[model samples]
Target chain A: MTVVTDGQERAGDVRLGRVGRGVRVAVALVGIGLLINGSVRASDDAWPFGPMSQYAMSVPDDASITYTRISAQTDAGTTVDVPLNIEGAGVARAEIEARTGEIVKDPSLLQQVADGWAKKHPDKPKYVKLELIRDTTQLVKGRVVGPPTPAVLATWEVRR
Target chain B: MSARTVATRAANWFTPAIAFARIAWLRTVLYLFVIVDMHAFVRDTRLKGEHPGLYQPLLLARMFDLPKPTVFNTTALYVVLIAACLVGASNYFPRIAGWIVAPAFTWWVLIGMSDGKVDHDHLALVIALWVLPTVKAGRRGRASYNDQARSESAGWVIRCVQICVIATYFLSAIAKLRSAGWALTWPGSAVLTWAIVRRPHPVGEWLLHHPWMLHVMQWVGITAEFLSPVILWLKGRWQLFGALFFLGFHAANTAILLIHFLPTVVCWLAFAPMERIVPWFQRRRASDSDAGEAEDQAEHGREAKEQAGA
Candidate 1:
């Protein structure tokens, strides 16, 4: 094996051919260009090359912080908060939040959440009704003013 | 300077020779992390398949006309990904394994992030997967962890990964600026308070009491992200410090927001000379074996003396 201790070209040192180098440079340029373009103009739909806009928007001090919660009335005649997590409902809160517009447009979209919960918890009491409740907390100077007010945005009666 | 001299300098900058062994080590780490990621962070990809009507394909997925995730297809993807990642991590058939992993994981992530929100944390990681396969591990392959031989191909790939990692940060700062109406409104705003209140974790709940500390943290975060490119230029201890600083940043985010940017964090290995780890371990092992041999020889000599006396 050819070993070179000095900072010089050696037989053992691997090098890319001219074509390989050209291809890599071109790829790098294009990738970087797309990233810049995505950040400047594209939305989340242009993902893998989209805006790094997580927490990019700032919330005003006096604005209300809204959270979409899933509350279900079970066959056991009790209402409980269905946690928007993979284990709880087989869906993330963010996923539900992302499609809030659609859910608001069509209340029937919530059947999926009920179906998911049923699939995950086969033995538990089936949900009779699933409500998308928005809990809005009023903030003053970055501090919570009072308890959040829960408003039901949409409701879906589960089909048994 | 002459145009020829400038062009040569630019070419040299793009292809600085880096140890091939670093690529071998990074490849193993990245591939293995894919398994951890699928099981934990993006576990919802499979669940999303069950509700295909909710599936909103990203631009890339839509452009390629990739099939929508189904129960069968997603399960198949999960099995295939796990198998491919294992083989790639093992350093066997790296090119083929890497090629499979690159597109598969990208598709997996596309499906996972197709909901309204797409995480910027994955930018570097996804790009790394694409570029890593371009370079081969030479004849030694998996056994080249201590190859010591430097290559321009390895350097080029490493550079590409590093750029993307920085872009995830630098562009994020720009995104913050753009979203805030080209003003520095982000650092001074109550975004953290809103997030903490929304999530309601213990540490974050405690942080809710102290508003000033959160404001300071926002300023520090944006400043670091804006200046993230300096890490690439930093050498030796400074570069290490820069990397560790970002890691600490992620740790704080986890502690407060419970958000783990592990994908981006794992790609930070690009900044390190990972190949040195193998040699370091080998040296320790050599010393350990030497000590063991000396002990054995001493025990044998003592036994020989005892027999002579007897």
Candidate 2:
């Protein structure tokens, strides 16, 4: 092949290899859009370009996550386990659990959590009390499920 | 030759040319990582596709009004993503393959992140994927070039990624400011306890007692984030120091939190002298060729001298 030294042609047919004025303008516009998209207005799924906001804010001193079986008294006064307390949320269970810990200290937030829960399980009867009882399971990482050591961390209560 | 030295090359404004070998090297690393990343999610992705009800379209997906995320759709998208990465990495039909890699991987990222567990660490990587295809990089394995063809465009592509790296840090600082109340009383120290209670490791437990240290780390993290843009403008030792500092930041983050931004860290190659490897090799090749030419000239000189005597 003859030597072409004008610094523009490639043997391959790649689109941007030639670097035209239009391509440069397009790249500049795209770059600006990318930089702005995430920081200005990130979409619901995820903004790869936005502010790295995860763990950006500080967790309060009293903030903590507890693994416990939440129990609530049914209208019939029978205590039943709140099944929504735990599931297959890898690592995120901590955040949910932590939020529960927060609601325990500040019962005023109970209405929001309850409203969301009611929306999810519309059929379940309203409970009189919400208490997270520690599971007596020894947590194992990879193998068998160990029993959580049961401990109670109470959050909300109904006078009725 | 007008590309100048490694240290000055990036500084050259609008230097459109780039070494093709560098493109080849970067593509291999990026394509492999993107492929492996998708591979890890194959079963999960396929599951998402199968369970159309669970397929929550993210903003981009919603805007595109993509077809329902049926098991067929999810799996098919991944299939395309993986195939594009493989063919692009292998450069089987290079130009076509290169064009295929970016959008396929992008679609996979949007789909994969639809569950609301989005990580911004891969944005620079995605940018890399898109920008990389623009350059007509040489064959795989080689990392240097002897020609000026396409060097300018490669430079532009790499510059875009480098900016992304800087943006990650620069914007992270902005994020911290938005939330971190900035005083010593800022409960940033509580993050250790917050994370520890979830995982309950010995080191984390120990650190919990040392709240003051966590506070110190918070200040350090913010400072590092704010100063991160130095990687672009800083020269010589300072630039290297900035890079090392960021690497340490990632390392400490992974060690403590078990969160690794492996892709973004890999994209840090844009700031590094990676493209220089090709230029160095090219310099050696040129020198060797020059030496060979000098030897031939000397032999002809000797022969001509003999003929003159005759």
Candidate 3:
């Protein structure tokens, strides 16, 4: 029943008692400190308090932009682009991009994408071989110069 | 200023009394939004569980030694979270439901964003969840929608949410500056152009032709974000304008880059006087009913006079 009217503390108005106020102040200070530390020093690993670095890096106008995509040779004897979406392969393009280094270091890791695809689409033509492809587009003065060049960074042949 | 005076001023600023009803309204909005968020936005948590090998736990998850998301655990978390959020939105058992939702959603978000890309938009949202449970309602464990009673606890929680929301913007500007090697090169760079070209919508594709306009937008965006804290001190219409401007900013980002920072956007309601919403609706309904009653009386009076004449 505690209420505050016009800056006057009326009886029964719920107040943050001395201890409550102190605790909150401490928590706020710590939280803000961590946020500052994260921005200054930490990486995405310190998430929920880490650097707010989405699109933080600047891309040069003339720089080449690379997009990673999965290309697969299906059992149907046709080469098709495997979508990097949850519905497509049970994984997102960002997920693949995040593990690009690991996948590049170990080409066999591409088998997981094949497994994911098989799990999602059991009736569809299974992937016979999976290639981790990078399509690089050259940009000049912030405009695309020409068609993108697709390069295969890693490949995995289905063992089945 | 004297040390005692400084302490008193700081205390007053942190614990300004605010209507408890605002918390009730905000809780409903935020908890309900969690359902929308889980299904539409971070729908990959369950799928990520299926591919546990891909789960690269973040720092907090790692520190907590949270088990790598499994089909069983993730599904369990999903069910628990939905149920808790629904109950929390109902305004019953506020603390219990709020506490359950706070950690579960945090863990859910942590799992969903375990990939190399952790979105900055979630910072304020996650903080709001944690702090909301600390504020208690009346003895019945619920704050009425029309409750005029103001509490310092409510103010503190709202302040925390507001601070985090502003921090999301202010810190992002700092991050941009840092990433540009502590130089002011970011605003002048073709970051927006690069993004547009990377994920080309029709509008963004057309924007690709106007690189100078994109550069100007980058400068304007960074400057506004850096100066975003001023919104906290702004009163009345200015504050609303600031909030609307950011919402517009989000709308523009969504239109161009297909990126919507809804999590942070929803938290902007903290800056609003949401306690008035329920009262406003109630008054309108009451007035409508009163007019109906007056019309009924007039009709009865006319019918009585006609009967007497007949």
Point to the candidate with the largest TM-score: 1
In candidate 3 the C-alpha lDDT for residue B258 amounts to 90
Alpha-carbon interface RMSD for all candidates, in angstroms: 10.8, 12.7, 10.7
Worst 10 residues of 1 chain A by lDDT: A1-10
Model 1 agreement with the true structure over B88-168: per-residue lDDT tens digits: 887778889999999999999999988776777888888888888878775355576765667888888888889988998
Candidate topping lDDT: 1
Weakest 10 consecutive residues, lDDT, candidate 3 chain A? A1-10
Across B11-77, the per-residue lDDT of candidate 3 in tens digits comes to: 6566767777778878888999998999888889998788777778898898999999989999999
Q: Model 3, stretches more than 4 Å misplaced?
A: A1-12, B139-143, B289-310
Worst 10 contiguous positions by lDDT, candidate 2 chain B: B301-310
Order candidates by lDDT, high to low: 1, 3, 2
Docking class of predicted structure 3 = acceptable
Pairs that collide in candidate 3 are A2-A12, A2-A13, A3-A13
> Which rank order by TM-score, best down to worst?
1, 3, 2
Retained native contacts per candidate, as fractions? 0.68, 0.32, 0.60
Residue A9, candidate 1: Cα error in Å is 5.5
lDDT by candidate, in order shown: 0.83, 0.59, 0.82
Please tell me the interface RMSD, in Å, for model 3. 10.7
